[model samples]
Target: MDNYLEDNMAKILLAGESWISTTTEFKGYDSFTSTKLEIGCTELLESLKKLGHLVTHIRAHDVPEDFPWSKEALDEYDVILLSDIGSNSFNLSNHVFSEGRPTTNRLELLKQWVLSGGSLMMAGGYLSFSGFEGKAHYSGTPIEDVLPVLIKPYDDRVEVPQGALPEIAVDSQITNGLGKFPEILGYQTVTPKKDAQILMTVDSSPLLVNRTVGKGRTIAYMTDIAPHWASQDFMAWENYGEFFSRCIKWLNKDLD
Candidate 1:
């Protein structure tokens, strides 16, 4: 095993990325329902782990109850990522929704955490950014203030069945050793902030954007980390592991 020092390893909190889908099949006036649970960020999780990062994943269903609400708990990780999850999952807790009790606003806590030197990243999906039908609802939230892009108030998904190839928009540490990237099937459309660095783009829209918020940093990857949007080809790219691991390293300030 490689003897890596403690500081070389980053503790990462990964919320969302898993979902359950229910489907009904009808045959000759008889219908049956089947439900399946799927995880979208397995590749990303494995990549981070391979690079020696300790990752804590809170699945979509478990996020409402399991996600950290206190600053001390949130400060335990060097970086946090919200992937394929909505703001409601963090804002509406079980107590607040079911019993109408007041709870700590986790979103606001996250914003403050980032401003205090914690890195944060948001990856796109049907339930990320403005998300499908605007249900994700992070447009004007505190999270948006820390992000490097402006979230659309409405649905932001741009479907590209023909595939949209990722292009390096600027020279940055995140894209340093990364060569030609693979084509992605789709991505959320977001505008880069004035002071934000655009590392990559797809279909001329911001794909990877980075910004510094006070003493911390933030990144917005306007595309899925897994399939449907992250095409099979994109996942299988030779530098797939390197590209993602580099992003985490940059966020943690491990890379200069």
Candidate 2:
């Protein structure tokens, strides 16, 4: 664990998505409070810091069309997280696809990074997985090649009013030792890939999944973090931090 952490420290990049032009748009309601320090990834960073990780945070705004898809940036982090951000962002104008041709394509770079063993995790939201009517369709990107779930031709999001109680995986490393955790508010229903291990399942679908992409591992949490969108349960739930932290640990355990 220590070797993985130390060796992978500089390789972890935490990319957050900010579509709202103003913080004023955010009203801490349901389970989110106006004063809560970490909504989205604000708290997630703190939690990662608590675990001794000094994360490099990049917002979707910071990336530009001419932005260099530097291998320095790619190799710097062991894991790159996409939370509610779309696939098109990385393919922005400045990025190069192959042979260093200038274009909006850092994905080929990201693909090489992962194939060479870099972890990636996607927490659910509008910019994730065929998000909101195929808005953030990750299916066509190199990311889709690594992700455990197949992106439906259209949106894969399912509205669950009654909510679902997923059956836990007995041998899940993520859920291991998490004794009696509070239930998640709700999960966005999705189809699972055969290559992926359905850690937790609902009905016949995969809710929590883990898969190995190249030499790196990827985990998918099909749920939201901010409340009212069914993430209220986890945010309000005491074990929210624990569960998320465990996920981070699994993704960047080598970074420690």
Give the number of the best model, judged by TM-score: 1
Model 2 TM: 0.77
lDDT tens per residue, model 2, 85-131: 77767665433434456553577777667777777888777778777
Which candidate achieves the best lDDT against the true structure?
Answer: 1
- Models 1 onward score TM values of 0.94, 0.77
**Clashing residue pair totals per candidate (backbone < 3 A):** 0, 17
Clash pairs for candidate 1: none
lDDT per residue, candidate 1, 74-107, as tens digits?
A: 9888899899899999888888999899999999
Off by over 4 Å in 2: 1-11, 22-39, 65-68, 94-104, 181-186, 253-256
Q: Which ten residues in a row have the lowest lDDT in candidate 2?
A: 1-10
